[model samples]
Target: MIIYTPPKPAESIPLIDLGPSFSEDLAARKAVAWEIHKTARDTGFFYIANHGVPQTLMDGQLDLAREFFDLPLEEKIKVDASRSSCTRGYETPGLQTLDDGSPPDLKEGFLIGVDLDDDHPYVKDGVPNCGANQWPEQPENFRTRYEAYVDEMFRVGRHLMGLIALSLELPEDYFAQGLKEPLFNSRLLKYGPQPVDAAFNQIGAGAHTDWGMITLLLQDDVGGLEVENAAGEWISAPPIPGTFIINLGEMVRLLTNGLYHANMHRVLNNHSGRNRYSVPTFFDPNYFYEVRCAPTCMPENGKPDYPATTVGGHIAEMYRKTYGLAA
Candidate 1:
């Protein structure tokens, strides 16, 4: 296994530009990869600028999300996540507890994945997280804007997969094969201000590491997201206009044999009486794809920490733990 080295001190998160050139020129792409590699090894979190996602698209998503979350409790419950065949519906506050033994998170969420019908090949084959999406009828333009945003994020996610492969010193397209028919999960989250008394244990979200390969997040100007540095100090990852926050997840850390840090992070509810909104798209490979240590990540004269496991199983177990469905 690769050894872990603690960061010397906390520093402001870096903002990198991932423009069209990143995917256009091979040499430049590798240079970019080296930069990402260093950042991943240190913090696994960075802000990406010039990502090509339109400002209007981002605005549309946030607008639609606010509209959905503002609906009456009864209206929101109509699409409750508990009703989904696959986790593709609305989740009320306190439904997820990311930090084991701590109070549940004080945020509401709406999760959507690769939208597929019952007749789709994957769904027909009984693959998990490949069912139809739950829709809200009140917002006339929600479906259109939401789907458009998801499609764009999916494109960016796929592009980042190649960059990550290059960063790991593997063939740039090494992850391409695995991502064929990949499972992409996106969540729209709303964190409202909580009273000081209720905020003791009811954090906006609890400290935890993400379970997927990578996550691309879009957050509004109202800041609250925090990431723990190697030195154990929590640092702010506030909103950066025209950029998306990207972070490596547990799957990547495991695949890299711990060379990369999948740092712990948590969110705080706004106390200014305003709400915080974020959209996080989880880019994961096909459910059945087995991940193992990459060649460059194997420790000298040693083996990987563990054998390969299906990405789906690893993610599902974490889901169970967070949702209190684990036995």
Candidate 2:
């Protein structure tokens, strides 16, 4: 059975200042990378400040989420995720069960990815989660604003990936090939206040590890997110203004041959009468990019613990498991 200890205040989760990373000096960039390397090895989760994304853009995205979720259910469901082949629209609460054997998550969500046309090669070939998005007619400037935020997120994601490579003592552009035309799934999630009579193990989001290489999460002030430390204690990851909570995913664990961790996290919006909102962008490599252990991460015997897998294949498997979708 799954058990959740009440979260204590965050003490070990580091807040990294990324300003140095954006500097032209190689030594400054490497200094930031070194901090990331230590954090990745220990927690696999950290908060990044001065990430270069504008505060206005960040606030606008959160405001948009509130506006979108405030719409009448019928209107919100107009562009239901069920209507899209690639699951690129609104999903009602209880639609996804992130933790196996637990009740479905208590959060509503909207998902979108690179806006591709039907004629695009990836769409034509039926690449999983790759296709046009199901946009809502209501929220007048939803598309334009959301897309703008997505563009900035892509930029930050790429830059962070470059730093990740440097963390592994590789060239900054080591993952350039995989990053070209990368695949990403950006999700806007809303969680209502925790119900008084909630079921066992029920929460806003379930205890689970992300499926991609990295996730950049922007959360509002109604703190509820929690991370499980190496000691199995639950630690609160409260919102820090102008910062995004960054976490490594299963793929990173594979890439580092288990030297780095892919920590388990979950959310519980227990605020008295308020809702919680968060946007997490699952930034990953190209769909077909092969994933394997980095040379520096290989074991003494020259054998990796995990087998090679493609980005698309791994994500597809995760979707099937969590969403119970057919292959």
Candidate 3:
């Protein structure tokens, strides 16, 4: 698990077309894998185009997000995350602090995970974060639309994971084996525009690396997302119609022995008068699955920079710190 940081990060993220992988031609699939390999190692961030997800469905998610945020503060708090044992439901602004000394993020969000029933084995077993969703009654179709989108996104994520496996020179199904009952989640966020005189640190999100395998983000036209380069410069990642921004996470970096980049990133306060909306889906392995450096990714020395840990444990520790629950 040798760590190899790039000397300089790319100024622009690679735009990859996944259409080739769907073909039966082996060469086409290999070509896609090569492209993914380069961009993943260079920046750990890229734009995916020609993905199977319908544009209409993507638009529908944004509509639902705006509508949900428009509800009165009282209605939004009805299913607040504080009421749930897992990380689901509405999250108020200034509640999540990404950096130790940075001001709480100036954004509001809603989190959703695999919708399980009380009778589900995980819920029955008292698994952390395996609870039913709390849907608001007013937005009658909100739950349905969100769940539909989640299913579609999950499908795409699994497909990408297979491609990632191929890129790593492993069997295509390698990751699928550990993804049974994955610990994934999706978030709907709204960042209000900041005042001209707002403090420099009043950001929508502070600099931090994602804790899971990967993240797929769909952003609105109003841009604010920025990725930090190796030189520590912030690169703006504006919204690109019909494209989802994909980035590797810490888990991928750990598993790849640092062949992939889990680059740090943050969001600036929305400067546009209209609220900025985004949907980011996190893809992870099963909660109890143990992760380690892959044989193909390890160097000759075979020394791991990170120790082995369960997916659930990694997430719990991150949550404890971010939520101020850690001593």
lDDT of each: 0.86, 0.92, 0.86
Clashes of each: 0, 0, 0
Candidate 1 deviant stretches above 4 angstroms: 1-7, 20-23, 121-126
316, model 3: CA deviation in Å? 1.3
lDDT of 2 by residue, 29-101 (tens): 9999999998897779999999999999999999999999999999999999999888889999999999999
Inter-residue clash pairs, candidate 3? none
Which residue pairs of candidate 2 clash? none
lDDT per residue (tens digit) for residues 15-117 in model 1 = 8778743567798888877878888887789999998899999988888889999899889888898888776789998999999889999999999887888
Q: Give the candidate order by descending TM-score.
A: 2, 3, 1
Report the lDDT of model 1 for residue 186.
88
lDDT of 3 by residue, 165-242 (tens): 889998888988777666788999999998676656878988899989989999999999999866677898889999
Task: Name the regions of candidate 2 deviating beyond 4 angstroms.
Answer: 1-10
How many residue pairs clash in model 1?
0
Error of 3 at 306 (Å): 1.3
TM-score head-to-head 2 vs 3, winner: 2
